[model samples]
Target: MVISSQKENDVLIKPDKVIKYKNSNIILNISNLSIGYDKKVIAENISFNLKKGELVAIVGVNGIGKSTLLRTIGGFQTKISGSIQIEGKELTTIDTLDLATKVSVVLTEPIASKNMSVKELLALGRQPYTNWLGKLSDEDIAFITKSVSLLELTPFLDKKCYELSDGQLQRVMIARALVQDTSIILLDEPTTHLDLYHKVQILKLLKSIAHKTEKTILFTSHEIELAIQLCDKMLILDGRTNPFEEPCKLIEHKNFETLFPADMISFDANSGSFKIKK
Candidate 1:
């Protein structure tokens, strides 16, 4: 999924040019993307480009189409209008098998059976490269082993997922995605059901993964303040503008001030965190 150069048609509609970050290539591109169902548009006119080695968070008020946007971009749902491209190729044009190799998605949905061991769960991520019988190849095992070490899952390898705490299970899920080894990883609320410290820990881990592996990681989260602290970039689904920019730039432009009702909570640009007016 390495894109050394962009084709003529690959230019972004908004910028009308390629987006380069820290000399990294743009891995995912969304232009004027509209996501919804039954002809009802939940979010529209959304556009952003994600570069390799970037950790991006999508934050918004409830029902602002955060998960829908993620689902649509992951190709799990239909897009009413607009384009989602990976490596300069339109998403819809890519075949299922090829797309599997390009993007890996991690939803907050519970696993079918929590009785499965951590090793068993991580093995599932290699399905894209497995043979018809689903036997593990030496190379697949090597990749899995490396991911386990990177994510520090060795101790929990034999433990059933149900035996793990919420934070541990979340780490296992992320390790599975790492095993997938896709160019882009999409997660819905990776830090859900965690305490404040764990939330910050997980987000920091994600940031580290993105920088170290150079994979584009995008996830929908409600941790706006944590995102502002740890994420390389953020996209706010504000229903109208849906602004996307770096945390500092977004704070400087006052984009976070109006995300919620002004009467109850307000964004404190100085601390880059939200505050209660009371």
Candidate 2:
């Protein structure tokens, strides 16, 4: 597959160079992936390579296994078949401790400690590197500080999680993942329960983080239009053919048109957004 950048002027004219560069930069590789419970597959034959510094989105209609795919990649659920690789190493070979250092996940699950301060919650991300007594090293402290600053959480550091708004808490959770210092970050519905402005704000922050830190940020989103505008690449999981490509290429190939039923909605390739059918 040809890897296209978001820039309209930049084009990959040489296939060989694109392949070589993609191979060297890939952070996560999924091949022939089938995800489900008890051998009942929800989706199958999924294949994609996520490169470093790319912000990708997994989008599909509800109940189409978007969360199932993310869960499988995060190693929280068992894959029915196929392989997942992180930085060229098979995911199965990586131990839990090692995996923590490679990938950080932010799920939609509610935090148990509503009274925990933002700083305390973010510091928990360093558990993989902490001593048996759960003490942070100087480096760990620095990481936490950097994460707090990166997400601009200094003002909320002392605030309890329960007191923060949904958007604020989501940023705190993302900061926690960032403090984990992983190369790949997986988030499930990061924009859930937020207003339109906050949703855009969060996605823009993620896009900036991916580009600035050279990290692969993959999240599942119901905000398809916003994702198409912000993400560098997109993975469409429509149950028939899962296609992972640059947003423009996916549109060019007419992949988005098959995403939903035609009776109510239709994809507009020119606008790169879905529209209500008249």
Candidate 3:
């Protein structure tokens, strides 16, 4: 319940001088977005911006429209109102193939092609760039190789997806997204079935990817504490007051304290943790 900014110095692939590069380009913009189905609005008046090299998390209690908002941004669902733009272009106006090139989405659903090899699954990410015969060009091969190297999937390239562990499979899925070569990546509950260790591992990998590759990574997670520690910014979907800000700023504003009922739990801002109240 308590959210605080904790810097991670142990990220892999640290650049020289550790310069905090200011990314001026907005990768994803949501303006007064109201997401829902049909005519009903689950959440309204939500606005946020994500920049390159930023990792942002969307968090809220169950049924607070986190997934709905993500789906809307990923172009999987229609927004009830407002606008979504990717790199200064309207998301709705982008063609499906073009959209695939600009944004990649990873959902909680299990991979249907379990028999597909790791390399084959990762290669599927290049479908947007492939010809009618689905042949991979040299550039496509390079992208696939880069993604595999980034995620350290070199050893398992020939292994079937069904044989990988949850964490390994998750990394493979992320690599697949990277092979798509998009500026923005959206994940819905990427830590859904992961254990605590695997959850931290996946989140750290994501943060590292965002910082190292300058990609805009946004995801919905119930692991608020982990997200606060690892993400650069956060979008808190409180249903009553949706706020997007840095974790420390949100903590200074006492946003996390109000995230849940106060009777059963209490937030310790100093330690950035929650405790049960007796």
TM-score of each: 0.92, 0.91, 0.90
Tens-place lDDT per residue, model 1, 1-278, is 46445343424433455633332387788888999996999999899999988999999999989999999989899899888988777788889999999999889899999999999999999999999988999999998998899878899999999999999999999999989989999999999899998998889989999999999999999999889999889999999989999999999999999999999999999999889998
Give all candidates' CA lDDT scores.
Answer: 0.90, 0.88, 0.87
Over 40-130, each residue of candidate 2 has an lDDT whose tens digit, in order, gives 9999988998988999999988988999988888889888887787877777778999999999999999999799999899989999999
Candidate 3 local lDDT, residue 133: 86
- Model 1, residue pairs in steric clash: none
lDDT, ranked from best to worst: 1, 2, 3
Quote the lDDT for 213 in model 2.
88
True lDDT of residue 251, candidate 3: 88
User: How close is each model in CA RMSD to the real structure?
Assistant: 3.4, 6.0, 9.0
State in Å the error of residue 65, model 1. Answer: 0.3
| lDDT of each residue in 52-165, candidate 3, tens digit only | 889999999999999999999889999887778787666878899999999998988898879999989998999999999889999999999998988899999999998999
Error of 1 at 17 (Å): 13
Off by over 4 Å in 3: 1-24
TM-score of structure candidate 1: 0.92
Query: After best superposition, candidate 2 residue 127: deviation in angstroms?
Result: 0.5
Q: Could you tell me the TM-score of candidate 2?
A: 0.91
